[model samples]
Target: MPTETEREESWLTRDELEDVRGRVPMLYVIAVPVRVGEAGDLDQVGLLLRASDTGRMERELVAGRVLYHERIRDALVRHLEKDLGPMALPRIPVSPQPLTVAEFFPTPGVTPYHDPRQHAVALVFAVPVHGDCAPQQDALELAWLTPSEAASTDVEAEMAGGHAVLLRQVLAHLGQTL
Candidate 1:
């Protein structure tokens, strides 16, 4: 059997991934990072600021693809650490479950989510982090906001690709919808 590293090394190249993505709905993991109060109440949600492919800055949740043979929980941890620094310390359960499943279509209006590059099915999770988070990789900054603030029109306008809708779903799942 191949080691995990070896298996990861066998992943498709960028062009191959794009070709396959066009032919099928790709699976993805989306995370909404949260900070909890002493009572374990969700105090704030974390969103990343990044410049999109279109050259405009946008707000987004921690999200990425689940590699071949990778477990769902492992994917969550990997993306969280990749986007939110290694010290984010996400609290993934032993058997993690998603808050909801979101489907992003290439065409808009099919669903609230839209990804023009490809159709993607995302398992959305609400993850709590106990340590400090410094935005990493393509993320310019990590902004922690209250649920109401996150639901505001200003923040909503800054988010694209259905991230604003994802925020509402996550907050509703946590019983903190604005």
Candidate 2:
């Protein structure tokens, strides 16, 4: 097994962290890795099932906090690999800009997205993966759903927090009306 120092080197460490969760917002990147058909139409939407901080199973997109010196693209790639298996090859977008910026507030009713843990600002993107995906670490399952199926009320209802809105936004961006 890897030592604590090795693990800490890969991720963040307590000494390098700050208590800025209350004083300021954090930067994050959210990815919606997809598979497309020959015609460039969206074929599948990837969803990750993981245990949230509250210990409940929640459906979430590939998301994580951006480290102090990490670029958004690098963070997206890192988180995607961490959640999806390392074998899962993600096609990071050529453009660095995100599809949307979601602001998650600690308090409810502040926005469509709420993170009771902290106030986070996320740059969301739609990534494409060309390799097989196996859930890793905290992710229990990696589910692939059709655009229409993903937009279904049942699927939306299963999404916790405001990830459902992000899903809808992705569909809309793909020219599909929910």
Candidate 3:
């Protein structure tokens, strides 16, 4: 087994990450936690309330980069649990596939999505969660909003980094027109 230090090396150091960010597009998993109503219909979407690196509060989906040796499904579960707490009970697929691939550009207007830090290609998954989700890490709250409420202009305005666009994509994948 790898030692603790070896395990820690699975993550990129700050300088290493910045150097790589300038060279290539990073792969990330964007997990959108959702709820299924009793009738087997989509109930709500979970959005995290947190402060961005700039100290402005924003709503966001659970997201993170996939480690060098990590599986995509594992990356999804890790980010979901880290942001939504251990009891979030995210439903991960045995054979995972993304609902869509969202490409984020460093330049604005390049796409509907923008990420000023680095160009990233993200695999988007709609994870149906069943258990209680107390916000974890930097998350201040987990808001479960109906599809309509989530797609509202007001809610979209509160989300930076084009997360609202991603949410809309997930909603459309789930058969919600909005």
Model 3 TM-score, 2 decimals: 0.93
Regions more than 4 Å wrong, model 1: 1-9
For model 1 the local lDDT of residue 157 reads 99
Give the C-alpha miss distance for residue 176 in model 1, angstroms: 1.2
Q: Mind giving the per-residue lDDT tens digits that candidate 2 earns over 63-110? A: 989986688888988999999988889988655778899999989998
- Give the Cα lDDT of each candidate: 0.92, 0.87, 0.92
Ranking of candidates on lDDT, top first: 1, 3, 2
Clash pairs for candidate 1: none
Q: Write the per-residue lDDT of candidate 3 for residues 39-147, one digit (tens) a residue.
A: 8899999999999898998999999999898899999988999999999998898988899999999999988889999999999999999999999998999999999
**What value of lDDT does candidate 3 attain over all alpha carbons?**
0.92
Top candidate, metric TM-score: 1
Misplaced by over 4 Å in model 2 are 1-18
User: Model 1 over residues 1-178: C-alpha lDDT tens digits?
Assistant: 8876674357898999999998998999999999889987889999999999989999998999998888999999999999998999999999998989999999999999999999999999999998989999988999999888888999999999899999999999898847
Clash totals, every prediction: 0, 0, 0
Which ten residues in a row are the worst by lDDT in model 3?
3-12
- Quote each prediction's TM-score: 0.94, 0.88, 0.93
